[model samples]
Target chain A: MARTLRSALLLAPSAVLIGIFLIGLVRLIASSVLFDGQIDLHHYVDIMNRPDYIAMLGRTLRTAALTTFFCLLLGYPTAYYVARYQGNRNILLLLIIFPWLVSIVVRSYGWVVILGPRGLVNGFLMWTGMADRPLKLMYNDFGVVMGLVHVLLPFMIIAILSVLMQISRNLEEASMSLGGHPFYSFRTVLLPLSLPGILTGVTLVYLMSTGAIVTPLLLGGLGDTMIGTEIFQEVMHFFDYPKAAALATVLLVTAMAVVLPLQFLERWLSKRLTDGAPS
Target chain B: MIQTPHIPIASIVETQNLARDNTPAEPILSIDHVTKRFDGATAVSSVCIDIMQGEFVTLLGPSGCGKSTLLRMIAGFETPTHGRILMRGEDMSHRPAYDREIGLVFQNLALFPHMNVFDNVAFGLRARGRTDGLKAKVQDMLALVGLDGFDDRRTGQISGGQRQRVALARSLVTQPDVLLLDEPLSALDLKLRRQLQTELKRIQQETGITFVFVTHDQEEALSMSDRIAVMNAGRVEQFGSAVDTYHRPATEFVARFVGETNLLRGQVQAASGGRVTLKLDNVNATVTVPAGDSSLGLGTDVAISIRPEHMTLGTGTDQPIAATVLSHSFSGATITYALDSAAGRLLAQVPFQPGGGHPLPAKASVSVGWADTAVTLIPGKPGHSQSDMEN
Candidate 1:
């Protein structure tokens, strides 16, 4: 019918855009994975076999794990506090999410001043006589994780808070009325229901940590040389586009292999939990 | 945290004796001088009421009458600003809702959506450290509420009526001493509400728990309650058996609230022992009333109340009042005849079967009268009792 044609015409642009992007992505992936325009597994084998590649992969995963854990550790309490605020909770939420509106580079610089060896943390500790020598606080794995957590915690808190808001106060009241202490209610009811948010936060931190170039390049220790820095080196310093492209392609495949399934699992769990709610 | 007030032995002895008897007067919970205020507006003001064991008492009121606030206070969701609630003999005021052994079914029926029927029913038991016996208790409660085999089914898979039962069993499985239902049947269809009212009464009887229900529907309150506390504007106007509150209402508000009424405004012509004669537009009538309220004197106006069913079309030799039939509705059980009289419009219910349709057509002149005992004088113009008014 002409109506169907009109509707299809209305949807055509978005569909065309998606098709174009998909085709470009597919061609890029295929070209990188093939060697000299021939199908091969050399890139994947190189990714696994090279000591530098393996070390960078492990470091990337470790930093991502560390970032995720710290973000959640700090975020849970902040989200809970925000949720429990009886009035002006929206204003508080805006303040919490305000850092996200700021440039991540700027937030990273704020940490640069706060965590530098001769900066706030070192000065405070040394002045207090807690340390004889200034602690090497910046340009390390710890500093990198601290920066990533700062960048990623808002996402965790906002995600958790939105989900937390969906849970009824009545459930807590019902739990208490049935003789649960507040702590017990939090542990049993709140923590279980918040798993989806936690999963989202972990996945986000892990994916971002694996590809983090700027933060590691600026603040991390030389030992924390992740795959992202290598990608940068291959493209800009070495100008070996073939190997760089191949490495980037392998990294992309590896991340999808891990993150996609994890994301799917999180979605599946979320669906199962909310599956049978009566309207 | 636990501050129990000193009980006068007289009240205790009265309840103790009732506890021994088959009567429902045995005390389960007593709310004394409870009040709640929000900023400037008072929601509940110094309300005192005793809930007897195994009794079904309804706080029948209009919206914003503080009935729900009072129920919430009893449920431990609202802390009373001024007074104490005692469960049996111990203070329940400061205790959390769960610790008070009270089961409150919310107006929304707040069934845990993620849970199946079995898990929902078992939730309370698990919370109370009775998880060891949870399975048996859940099975027993589901069966008690007529949802035994439906336990494994999710809440979304059930009917509205079935969900309500699941909520009931969820609250009831904890073996609470008091079951507080807030407009529990309001969400159901008309037929379902009627059916559930009977089921609720049966459930209450079977469990023998004190049932305190809050409802704006007069019919629900009257049919389900042994005692109805008619409230308005955060205060109780009358608390008594349904029959007494309906027939011998103490205020004009009560008469109008519980059923359809014909209220006639008249000036008192004379006063005598237990009686008064009033003149309305030129017709005179005599009414019997209680003596203590002496506000009405000769020449002072008062409202006389007579239910429609009590008055009939007759040119009786005893008492004669004339009217014309204005409108009529013919239901199978009774024909409601609205008569336009000098006093105002009056509603009369004529039984269709017993009378075999002695239908009075519209615009027909008719004489309506009742026995001298049937009418009562109401004090003041009904001035809106907030307690008994429906939202």
Candidate 2:
């Protein structure tokens, strides 16, 4: 009994914090129905009927999916190179993770300077005569995606690199000695062994991008209104707490629906990839 | 040293000239004065050996003695700093492992953990782009190693002995010109190791494949090899058959490293007519080295080596060395007595004789003696004093 008490004491802080959040969420859900001293489903029905709100939600999911796909495509080779690098490994790792030390808001604003209409890329293009005028680069969906990918890429790389380091170098050598080429050896042996890292990186990138607010606010235009921006405007500008609460609950459920299936797929794929024979 | 040519049973039918005549056949693989240097320290220094076709040769030595380095160089994993490796008269010193046409069974067995037994055995065949009859070839190789029904089992799910067979089958299915085994049986238990050693010898004989095995275990080298290259300090000390290596060790390090022996320090008192007499250091006895051996010179210091089994509990015409029994260990068939004598500590092995009651107790005074012809005279003076199979 004493040991159980000690364990509970060790877990008290996190449990208390989660309990407070749960209670606040329950109250918010109750208030969403208890609008104007009457219990009704007014806010939830309003959110579902609004085409603009539904479009915003769809745009947010699309942008997050695109960012995660690009991050995976770019981050996997980068992580593989960094993990296999022999010389000055600490420097290479520090270079990859250095952007995380800066605040995400600061990093997003930095992207704003680079992706503006008269930014460095546009200036270079105009000077090289590749474009006659400055291209509209910032205040768009493309700008938002670039900013999100920049902010979230370190997480993906670090996850994959950690798993790559655990794989034995001898496995590759054994494959080559058995008459396999370098590419064939990597595809057959190294790729399957690194599946766990790849799954973790993809899931983390997807969730973080979907819930992003600051990057879209700073780098996107009026036409690229995401669900996070709408929720922010509903609570702070419109003072519609019930509508914001209902939207927040819907966003959380939708994110779980996407992420949970992905987690199950990860477990299933890892099993199949590592399973050697039918028996 | 004169080497007896190895004759594989299948080779007699294929190579009619070799079977019908007495002329020597060319070596299948030759390490011509190969040397490997890591940074500045020499790992293998000017080591030369010729592996005959269809022969089983072992590079035997203690750790850090450069046996593994030599084997890796032959496998095309490490390029020699000097000299060259020739496979059937073609220089393969610069070839990559995949292009060298040699198979290697690593010390860890290195079976692909993500592959099943069938896939592991088929890896080489597939890599070489041989898809036709791959399944049948894998089955035959598995049966050859006595793992016929384990096709679907993962490498991690198999036993150690089964893994050994898988590794062997994986390498042998490709039919490389030579097979290099880097102490593949060292990780197994004694009984399992013995069982696999017999299997390895049988496989080599049945397939008529040239096998170059590297091991630090002297007994494994002795029993499994047609020729043993006894190595020390990055050089081949002696290379000969097992009987010659045991009974006629060429160096003091080989005599000490290969088996349990008692080394006595002495100086040559007289040398004449292909014979020499050595005056022992502290035993107050003179030993006569037999005729037909003229290596010793007058006043030259030497080590006289006598195996523990050669020494018996008896007195000779020469004064019997007085000794007190320090301890005795009873192995199943033999009783090995550790003795403290005037010359230093020595060991003697005697058969248990089944119902021999109990051994002589510790501290009991006794006499130890051996025939002069039984002692091998090593030229180099002993460097370290105490000796028990380690130099």
Candidate 3:
């Protein structure tokens, strides 16, 4: 049918791109399992058994989780302000998105200039006689998390804002008319209605931070190397392709393990939220 | 007494009597000189209205006439730029919506989409922290609105009419001193609108809650309100009973907005006592109508409103004006005839008899006459010339 042909044509470009990526993924999996052209599970077993790799994975997950939490804490209020602002909302939204327009690598380096030992914050503290010495602000887990949250804050804010804009102002008024205080009305009405956006922002920031490389490599200390930096060092510095591929496979599986459950929760929550709503 | 020839002063006395019979000593809610301005443009001018307890008072006007703004001020959703709102003699103008204890059923119903009917109805009770017998009270309110078993369904799962009932039940469950409805029935179909109008009136009576409803439909206001406040251009043009508003409109805008009427331009020829005889423009006829306002001096220009039903059409010699039939239309209950007369193109509604065959043919000569008591002198210059007053 013509309809079938048109749909096929529409899907061809994205399908071809995904197919190429899938072929690369298959090669990566094969390399992870192959040692000297013989099929083996040693590489994957070696990764699972290694204490350092285990620590790296744990550190990566913890950093990602912290990044997601901080992003939500900071983004929610900003998004709420922008969504409910009485003036031109576009100006506020533009400010939120301005950082995203810059390259993430450049922005991460900008954080280095600000958070360095001799940087603006330390300089201010020292100049004000608040600190006797320059405080350790970078080359640690704290630095890596700060950078990741900065890079991902806009995503979280934008996600929450889109959903907040959809909720009618009338619902809040109705709650207030029924004897709810402003804060009570927000918690009982606005917060619950915007849950889908929160979930989306949380999942997106978590997934992106888990696989982040540049920020962790630049900002973290030598012992604070995450799974992404570990995989990068294996493949590029040591030229250990098999180990790198195995680590990548581990990272993919771990990310999926976190996201799959979240995807399910998102589905169930969306069904409950929009079950009988008018289209 | 000055010889007031044909003024029906008795009807005015009857209206006052009826108002006195039902009106309570103290009004439950009073909007005293309230004015709302948004960014320098006035939405509601200095308007005052006293709503009695257990009375259904409608703020009726066209869109942008400040009826909704006035209602919002009464509901405490919007603070008035000027003036005080008194609830039981207490100044509540500066109070928040929650502290006002006023329930408002919004134009869109504003039902919580996230909550089921039971939770939605019980929300007010829970918000007020009065959890004592909350479930039973919600159930009772639902039953009052005839939504007994629909508590389990989400707001989106129900029909539009059912959602309207849910909104009503939710607001009434809080047992607020006054309930404000902002054109809640405007979304439904005509048949459903009529059914809900009756339902809303019944609920208002059963709860004995003062209702300040805002709507733009004149007929809806006329049918559902105990007293209707006809608004225009950010001001209350007239606030009175439906019969008083319809029979004796206070302004030219009220005369035209409240119902369909033929506005005939005229000038006062003779003024005596509480009546004035106005000689109509273009037509060689003089009509004596009640001088409701004492400002009518001799030779003053005025416009008189004549309801279509009041204008009688016949071939009798006593009929004052001669006209030709322009066109006609058949509604189920009445046959409306358009007559092209020397006065202007006037509309006349006649009761349709089942046995009466057909309307007068176009271009047929006819005679038009109306009782002098039926003419209401509009207290302003005629808005348009007599020829263009077809609407």
List TM-score (chain A only) for every prediction.
0.86, 0.90, 0.91
Interface RMSD of each: 5.0, 3.2, 5.3
Top of the candidates by TM-score = 3
Residues A198-272 of candidate 3 have per-residue lDDT tens digits of 989999999999989999988888887999888889988999998899999999999888888988988786676
Candidate 2 residue-wise lDDT, A1-279, digit = tens: 999999999999999999999999898778678867788997788888988888888988999999998998899999989887868899998999899889988998898678777788888998899999988888888989999889999999998999999887767767777777877777777887887898889889988888888899999888778888778888999998888888887887788889899889888876775654221
TM-score of 3: 0.88
DockQ of 2: 0.32
Candidate 3 — which residues are off by over 4 angstroms?
A1-23, A37-53, A85-88, A267-279, B1-23, B282-284, B293-295, B314-322, B352-358, B365-367, B383-391
lDDT of 2 by residue, B256-333 (tens): 888998888889998876677888889888777763343766888888788998887753343457788999998988
- DockQ (C-alpha based) per candidate is 0.36, 0.32, 0.40
lDDT of 1 by residue, A1-279 (tens): 999999999999999999999897787667666767788777667777888788787788788878888888998889878877888898998888788898877888888899887889888998999987878887888888888888888888887887778777777776666566777667556766777777777777778877888788777888668778888988899987667777777677777887889889887875665443211
Which CAPRI category fits model 1? acceptable
True contacts kept of 1: 0.42
Cα miss at A193, model 3 (Å)?
A: 2.2
Cα shift from native, residue B144, model 1 (Å): 1.7
TM-score of 2: 0.80
When sorted by lDDT, best at the front, the candidate numbers are: 3, 2, 1
Tens-place lDDT digits, model 3, residues B83-141? 99999778999999988778989999999998889888888877887777666778888
lDDT (0-100) at residue B341 of candidate 1?
76
